[model samples]
Target: MSELSMGDALKLFLQKSRLKGSMQAMQITDIWAELMGKTIARYTDKIQILNRTLFIATSVAPLKNELLFQKEKIIQRVNEALGENLITEIVIR
Candidate 1:
């Protein structure tokens, strides 16, 4: 039998683990939800995550400003949780 090169070994591991895509997606959503829950718990009902985008709806228009102010913190927290930059943008409405 031939030896497996490092690249091939990584590919085989990904295929065997069956977690190359969906797992990352799930983790992204989970991280988004958790971060919102922790940092913006009051707005949980208004938060939505879609394909690398985050949407937050607030009943009070002022809260939009609050969300804007915390944009960097939110992104940093989510990235820390996910171990990568998953959320590309955030919208407050």
Candidate 2:
């Protein structure tokens, strides 16, 4: 087979890491849940994980604001969950 273009590769990744399914993995979801907690998770959704970074989308602007407000803390909490700094950045949009 030929190599995948960036877009194709990303599409395939999204397919495999079905947000709900990906959340099933203890390593990924537990850590995520732990960091954000139930209340925050309800409002925010993990949209993508690319280049070792996490991208989240929030329905509530306040949650987005909170994440921005506690950027460093959130980063640290997420890093702690992953046991290493897998996510270098968190984007809220």
lDDT of 1 by residue, 1-85 (tens): 8999998998678657856455655665566556666545555445555667766677666767888999888877766786677
Q: What TM-score would each prediction reach against the true structure?
A: 0.55, 0.62
* Residue pairs with backbone overlap in model 2: none
Q: Put down candidate 2 lDDT per residue, 1-93, tens digits, no spaces.
A: 899999888767855775523442345655566667878877776556666666778888888888888877876777676556756787888
How does each model score on lDDT?
Answer: 0.68, 0.68
lDDT of 2 at 74: 74
* Model number with the top TM-score: 2
RMSD of each: 5.4, 8.7
Candidate 2: which stretches are off by over 4 Å? Answer: 1-26
